[model samples]
Target: MTGTTLTTADLDPHRRRILFRAWHRGIREMDLILGQFADTELKTLEGEELAEFERVLGEDDNDLFKWVSGEKPLPEHLKTPLFERILAFRPEEAFKPVV
Candidate 1:
């Protein structure tokens, strides 16, 4: 899909904003990674997890992409379980061969 299928109608303000940001990250790679993660996980995230997600979203897309893709190691401060979740949350479309 070109964009999120998750509806924001029932989401809290925080989640709505976070979802939008996740989908609109500067890079399409990051957008797909984070946006798909948010689409599946945002509704279930509790307050702390939401906070962690927001914090992770604040990182530079270049560094976040490297960290997520394993091209570079996660910095000490970013080596949290949430980041691990992000590392594992690969949407099937992300791996599809480009045409």
Candidate 2:
């Protein structure tokens, strides 16, 4: 199977939880942002990267959205290469929607 193809059950509990959290954020916009990132990138993250991702997930959704969208500067703790990677993510360029 392709790297992008994964069921939540196929992942370990930690990764599965992150994926679910990503897809179920209260705001639709944050859902799309983190959900796409989790789908395409979560399986590839290293231990430290996963830690960073989890920290990000623990944040308040609105603040996370603002940081990712550059409406507010990322706090020092949230400033990591992985966070930058997430901030830079763009699902529009990554996938072609069914028309």
lDDT of 2 by residue, 1-99 (tens): 222345876799888888888777766667777888889899899788898888788889889877776789889997778887887785563234445
Question: RMSD (Cα, Å) of candidate 1?
Answer: 1.7
Model 1 alpha-carbon drift over 4 Å, by segment: 95-99
Candidate 2 error regions (>4 Å): 1-5, 92-99
Q: How many backbone clashes does candidate 2 have?
A: 0
Residue 56 in model 2: shift from native, Å? 0.3
List TM-score per model, in order.
0.89, 0.80
Could you tell me the TM-score of candidate 2? 0.80
Span of 10 residues, lowest total lDDT, candidate 1: 90-99
- Screening candidate 1 with a backbone cut-off below 3 angstroms (N, C-alpha, C), the clashing residue pairs are none
| Candidate 2 displacement at residue 97 in angstroms | 16
Q: Could you tell me how far off, in angstroms, the CA of residue 20 lies in candidate 1 after the best superposition?
A: 0.3
